[model samples]
Target: MEPHAPAGRLAARAHLLAAAGRPEEGLPLLAAASGTTPAQHWAGVPWVADPTLGPRIEPGLLARTVMRLCTAVGDPAPATTVTSLRPYLTVVRHAVDAHGEHAMLLGAGSALARRLGEVRLAVEWAGRGARAQPSKLGEIWLGYAYRSAGRMPEALAALRRAVAYDPDDLSVYADVAATLADLGRLDEALRWTELALERDPDFDCVVHTAHRLRHRADGDVEHLVALADFVRDHPDDAHEHTDLEECCRNAAWLGGLPSGTPLPAGRAPVNAQPSADALHRLQRVSGPAWPHPPGAYDRALGLVLVEPWELLALLAHPETARAEQQDGLEVWACLGLLHHGTDEPWLDSSRRRLLLGLLDGEVDRVTQAALFAMVAYAWVDPEAREDVAAVVAARLTETASGANARAVAELALAAPGLDRPTRELAAATIRVPAAPRQRGRGRSLLRWRRD
Candidate 1:
C-alpha cells in the first residue's frame, strides 16, 4: 500500500459507517483524514492514465466523500458545520460544470435539500443534474420535487418521461399512479397501479396506493382488509404501518365507530355469481353516463354489478360482525351514496356531520375536501352551503400552493347551493398568486414554490 493509502481507506470506511446509520462513529475518522494532503490521499490510487489500475481517489470521489459525511450528520448539525460543508457542495457543482464528471453531485445536492425541506432548491439542483446528464435517477428526483410542490401536471409529465426512459422502474409507475389519483382520475390511476404491480408485485408503494385508489373510486373495504394483513406480516415497513393506520382510522370514522377499532385481517374471499336483474342493470347503464344519481337504486346496483364483491360485503354486514351495531349510513357513504332529486334527512345530517368535522379540524383536509366535492351537488341548504363555502374559501386563502388553492376553488365551484358572496370569495381566492410558472427551456425543471 502507498503512504497515503491509509487516509483513502479511512475515508472509505467513514463513508460506509455513515451509510450504515452510524454517522457519529464515522465523524472522528473523517476528521482525522481532513488534514491529509490531496497528493498523499491519492498517492496509491491510480488516475485515468493508468488503465490497468482498478480504481483511484479522484477529485470527484473525494468531493463526494466529503458530501456523504456532511449528509450523514443530517440537517440539524451545528451552524458552523453546515456552513463549512456548503463550500464542498459548491466544489462538486463547479467540478460537474467544468469537467462534466461527478454528475451524481446534482442528485446528492437535491436529496440533501429535500431532506432539509428546501423543496424549491431541491428542484433547482435536480433540474441542473438532469440537464447535466439526463438519467432516470435525476428525472425521479425532479418528479418528486414537482409532486412535493403540488405541480401535479408537471410531475406527471416528468414521471411519464422517466417511465419512457426506464420502463422497468417500478417506483416511477407507482409515482404515476399516485399523481393520477391526486388529479382525481381514479380509473387511470388504478390502471397504472395495476401495471406497477405487474412489474413488482410486492412493492409497498404500489400496493398502498392501489388500495387507496380502490377505496376512493368504489369504496372497496376488501383492499383495506388486505392492507391490514400486509401490515401485520411486515411490521418492519414503516410505510405499511402508516398506510394501515390511516386506512383504519378513515374506515372507523366513516363507520361511525371509534377510531381505534381493530382492523380486519386477511384477504376477502372471491365469489362470482351475479343475479339476472343486476346483469340487466349493468348492461343498461354501462355506457358513458354510468355514474348516475348517487341514491338511485340503479346507481347502487350498477356499482355492485361492476364489482360483485361489494354487494356481497354489504349484504354480509362485515362491520357488524367485526364491531357493534352497524350504521348502514356509513356503508352508503362509503358507496358514494348521494341524494338525488330530493334531499333526505339522513343524507343532510350525515353531510352536515362531515362538513362540521372539516371545520373542527377533525378530518384530514384532502379527504374532507374530496367528500365535499362528491356530495356538493346535493348540498342545497343555504346556511349549510354558506358554512361549507366559507370554510373552503378560508382554506384556499391559507394554502400556499397553487395546486392546493386550485383544488379548493374547484371544490367550492362544485358545491350546489353557494350564495353569491361565498361564490365570489371562492372565485377571488383562485386569483391569488401561489407560484410563478416556469418559462423558457429547462426553466420548468427548477420551478420553486414561493411563500
Candidate 2:
C-alpha cells in the first residue's frame, strides 16, 4: 500500500532538501510529517512515505543509509531502518531468489549488511544469499563472505560456482580466477582467466589475468619472455612495472627464473591509483581497508604456485620497499615451502626469517594469522606431504575456518601421505563428488599421473 499523499510529498521534499543542502528546513518538514505516523521522526522525516517508495527501493538506498549512519548523531538505527524497508527488501529478495533458488539473494542482503558495518550479519546474509541464488555472482559474494567469516566449504563452493559461471560476467572473472589460484585449482583457473582476457583484451581485467596465466605450472614460457620484452621496451610507462613484476613472479612460480635484466626498479604501485598490474581492486568496497595490497596480493598468488625467486626479485626492487610489501613477501615464503619441498635450500630463507621475526611486531591480526598459515605450510616436508596436510587440518580445526584455510586443509589431505583424520576432514569439506574432472589434449599435464 502507498503512504498517504501528503506524507509522500513531505518525504520527497525532505529527500530533495537534504540533497540540495537545506536539511535543516527539510528535516523539520519531515519530522512534522513523521510525527503523524507509527514511525518515529527519523531524520525528522518520514522515510519511504512516498507513493513511489514501493517501486523505488533498491540496494543503493542501503548504501545511502550506511553513509548517512556513519555521519549521523549517536547510534543510527541501521538495523531498524533496514528492517522497516521490508516491503522493498521482499520484492528484491523474491526476484533474486526466484531466479536461482536463493543463492544470490545472500549477496544482495549481505551487501546491505556489509554497507551498514554489520560484518558478521553481512557474512550470514551472504551465505544465505549464495545458497538461495546459486549464480556466479551469488557464489562470488558467498565465497568472499565465507573467507572473511572463516567458513571454508562454503567459500570453496562459492568460488567453484564462480568459475563454473564464467564467460557470462567478465568483471567477476578476476576474483574467481584469484580464488582458484588460492585453492590450487591452477589449470582450470588459467583456462577461464584466459577466456576472460580473450573477451576483453584491452580491459585491465584481461591484462591482470593474462599476467597471472603465464605463470601457471603449465604456462607458456615464450609468452613470459615476450611479456618481459614488452616491459623492457616500454620503460617509460612506469605503471606496467606491476605487470612486469607479475610476469616475473608467474614465471618463477612455474619453475622459471626472472631474467636478471637490470632495468632500474620503479616505485611501488599506489593503492589509490588504477595501475595496470594491481592484484586486487584497490577501491574500498565497504570496509576500512581493501583486502590486500594489489602487488602484495599478486605476490601471494605467486607463492601458491611455488615461485619464490620472482617474489624475492619483486621484494628487492625499489617498488617493493614499503612496509606493505612484507605481506606479499611472507606469503611468498610460505608458498615456496609448500610448492617446492621445504627441504630445498636457500629459497625464501631470509624472507621467511623476516616474516617470523615480525610475528610479535605491529602487523594486523588477520595479516598475522595469514602469515602463520604460510609458516605452517612451509614447515611441511615435501616428502611427507601428508604431514604438512595434517598441520593444515589441525590449523583448520583450531581456527574459526575460512576459504583459504579450508583449501589448505584439503590440499594437505590430498598430499602423498594423508592419514585417516585428514582424509575424513577433506571429505567432509566437499558436499558432493566434484563434477568429473574435464580434460582436453593439453589437460594431460594435469592428470593424476602428474600428481
Candidate 3:
C-alpha cells in the first residue's frame, strides 16, 4: 500500500470533488472505486508486528482525514460509498490501543458508528476509547454512546467521570441533565440544570434545558413561559438556534403540558394569542396527554402557533409528519401566509431563501400543493409568487385533476402576481364551476372555528 501514493487516493480525490460542488463529476468516480479501495490500510505483516504502529497512516493523520472526509461527503448521503471507509476503523482502534490517548480517532469512530446505527459498536468503541483516555472527550462520548444504547446507569457513571475531569464544562452538565431526564429522574435533572443556570443564566443551552426539564416534569407554567421568553428574545442566537429548535421540540412532544396549567407572568410574542385562544377553544378531547402541536407547545407565551423552524424540520424529514384529521399541513402553512399582509417580519431574507428552496427542490405532492396554494397571497413578493405559480403550473400539466384541486387553484388565481400561463393552468384545475364566495374566510391555513 505504501509503494505508490495512498491506496485510495482516487476515491479520496473523487469525494473531495463531490464536496467541492461537483457531485455529478465526482459521484461516479467515488462509487466506482470506494468499495474496492482502502484509503489507508495495514501494509506490514501482522503475525509479529506491534498493533499500535501497524497501519500505513499515522493515527492522528488518519483521524483528521476521516473526520474531514466525513464532513465533505456528508452523513446519510453517499451512504453506500462511505461504508467502504469502515475498514479504517480497525486501523484507528489499533493505533489508539497502543497510544491509549487518540482522542480524535475515538471521536471519529464513535460518531461514525453512532450515525450508522451501530449502537453496540459505538458503545464498545467508546468504552475502549475512554478506558485508553479517560480524562479527554472520550469520557463524554462514552456517556453519549451509553445514552444512545439506553444504558442510563453506565451513561450516568461515564458523565460523572466527565464532570470530574472538567468540572466547569457546561455541556457536561447539560448532558447529565438530559440523561437524567431520560431515566425519568426529572427532579435530579432539574437540580443539575439549576447548577448550570447559576453559572450562566444567559447560556441558552442550560437555560432552555432547565426550562424544558422543569416544565415537562411539573407542567409548570413559569418554566414554560421562561422557555417561551427565551425563544422570543434569543430566536437567532449565534450558535444555538438550531440546537434550541431541536431540544425544545423534543421537550414539547415527548413531555406533554397540562391544558389547565395557569398562565405565567409573561409572554414574548404578542401575535400568537389568537392561535392559542383558537387552540384552547377547539381543544381536542384526548385524555390527559394535553397534546400540543409541533412548535405550538408554549401557549402561555403567546407564541403557540406553528413557526418557521417547524417548517424547516418538516421539510427535512424523509416523510413529512402527518395529521389524519387535518388537511395537508405544509399546504395549509403556505396558504396561511396570505394573511401576513404584505409585510412578514419573520419572512426575512433567510426565510425567502427557505421558501424559494421549497419551490425549486423536489418536494412531495403535499409540498407541491403548498406551492400552488401560496399563489394567492398578495403579501408575498410578486416575483417570488410568480416563480411558485410557474412551478405549480408546470406541474399541473402532469397531475392536474380538475375537480378536487379546483377550490385551491381557483383561490390561488383570485389573488395577484400570476402570469397568463399560471392563470390558464389555474382555470383548467377548476372543473367544478367556479362559485366565488367571500374571499376573507377560507384562505387561511388554520382550520379553527375562529377561521
Top TM-score: which candidate number? 3
- Identify the runs in model 3 with alpha carbons over 4 angstroms from their true place: 1-54, 66-103, 220-232, 235-326, 329-339, 342-451
TM-scores for all predictions: 0.39, 0.31, 0.46
Pairs in clash, predicted candidate 3: none
Kindly list the per-residue Cα lDDT of model 2 for residues 39-72, writing each as its tens digit: 4433422333333332333434432332233233
For TM-score, candidate 1 versus 2, the one ahead is 1
Error (Å) of candidate 2 at residue 318 is 19
Residues 1-451, model 3: lDDT tens digits: 1233343565566557645754334433433343344233222223213243324345666565555544543433244544455544445556556555666677667765665567798788788777776664888778878887889999998998998989888878988998898888888998998898889887777777787777567543335434545666776754443333443343322222212221111111112233333323222321222112223222212212444444333323213222442223343343333323335443354434444445442224333434433432222233454555455566455435532344445334433445666666666666455433322211222211211
| Superposed Cα deviation of residue 417, candidate 3 (Å) | 37
Candidate 2 lDDT score at position 426: 55
Candidate 1 lDDT over 23-76, as tens digits, reads 444443553454342223221222211322112234445445645544454433
In model 1, which residue pairs have backbone atoms overlapping below 3 Å? none
Looking at candidate 1, the ten consecutive residues that score lowest on lDDT are 442-451
